[model samples]
Target: MTSNPPIPMRPIRTAQSRFPWHHFSMRFSSTPRGARLARRLAGERLDAWGVPYGSDTHDTVTLIVAELSANAVSHGLVPGRDFRLRLSAEGTTLRVEVTDTRGEKVPALVEPSDNLDGGGEGGRGLLLVAALADRWGWYPCADGPGKTVWAVCSASVLAAPSP
Candidate 1:
């Protein structure tokens, strides 16, 4: 009779455990064009972080960026000032942040139905953000006279091994 040696046990690593933190930040003009650019750049950055274009994680993050950027341009715009976009990924979490120099105009999440019933063309951005993001909020910027709106979405795909 032959006896096989016991196989050595190894700790299993999850997708969240294997992924390292990644960050991207940039400032854009407080204009419609700048907002568009921010969304495009965010998509590219997600691709670089292994989130892949067209994936759910990629799309969600991009949409959040688009909405936040648009709000910054339309509501938070300060002449001669630019807005800032920051993206950070750690494990299964992806965070999107948009900062503009308008501390007075804080965002609020209102019922979407209310706006739609009134035949309003806008005012649903925050509602969409609330639906899509696992968690979101805003705070006054620590270093400047402005505010930063942020949202976080869970990206299970971020844990998948890169092909």
Candidate 2:
């Protein structure tokens, strides 16, 4: 009989294990007011998470939430349905998710062109989201209708996790 050596097991290190995990979610009407609320609520939650109200992290996350929510209202709105906003924090990363009942209207990234109109602000919402978020993407909602657009912002530009 041959005996096999025991395999060493490594500990799984996750943000949940290193720091307190925070999450917030709310459903809002698919209207302009809802987009505004999403942005405001995200900022409030980040403040509660100890990021401070006017810190860079807070500002970036707020902008991401605003842009994503606005996109949902303008492009993904489905009559009689509401949109959802979710925020989660783990370790040095904060994530934002906006879900609307229009799975067919998935967001696409547009290349930056010299002729783009922004006047130094940004060409569009997704463009601002792309510039601000360390990472961003979209996926079909698990429960029922629509898709979820998500963004992640890191504590610092250098601290962004590799793709």
- Please provide, for model 1 over 54-147, each residue's C-alpha lDDT reduced to its tens digit, 9 standing for 90 to 100: 8776788899999999999999999999999999877678899999999999899775554555566678899989888989999999897999
Clash pairs, model 1 backbone = none
Query: Which window of ten consecutive residues has the lowest lDDT sum in model 1?
Result: 4-13
Question: What is each predicted model's overall lDDT from 0 to 1?
Answer: 0.84, 0.78
Candidate 2 yields a Cα-based lDDT of 0.78
lDDT of 2 by residue, 1-163 (tens): 9995643332323433322577889999889999998888788776666666766666788888989988889889989899999998776677899999999877997754666565543438888888898889999988888999998877553222222
Residue 1 in candidate 2, Cα distance off native in Å: 74
The C-alpha local distance difference test score for the whole of candidate 1 amounts to 0.84
Assess the local accuracy of residue 52 in candidate 2 as a C-alpha lDDT between 0 and 100. 62
Error of 1 at 50 (Å): 0.5
Residue 3, model 2, lDDT? 96
Checking candidate 2 for backbone clashes, the offending pairs are none
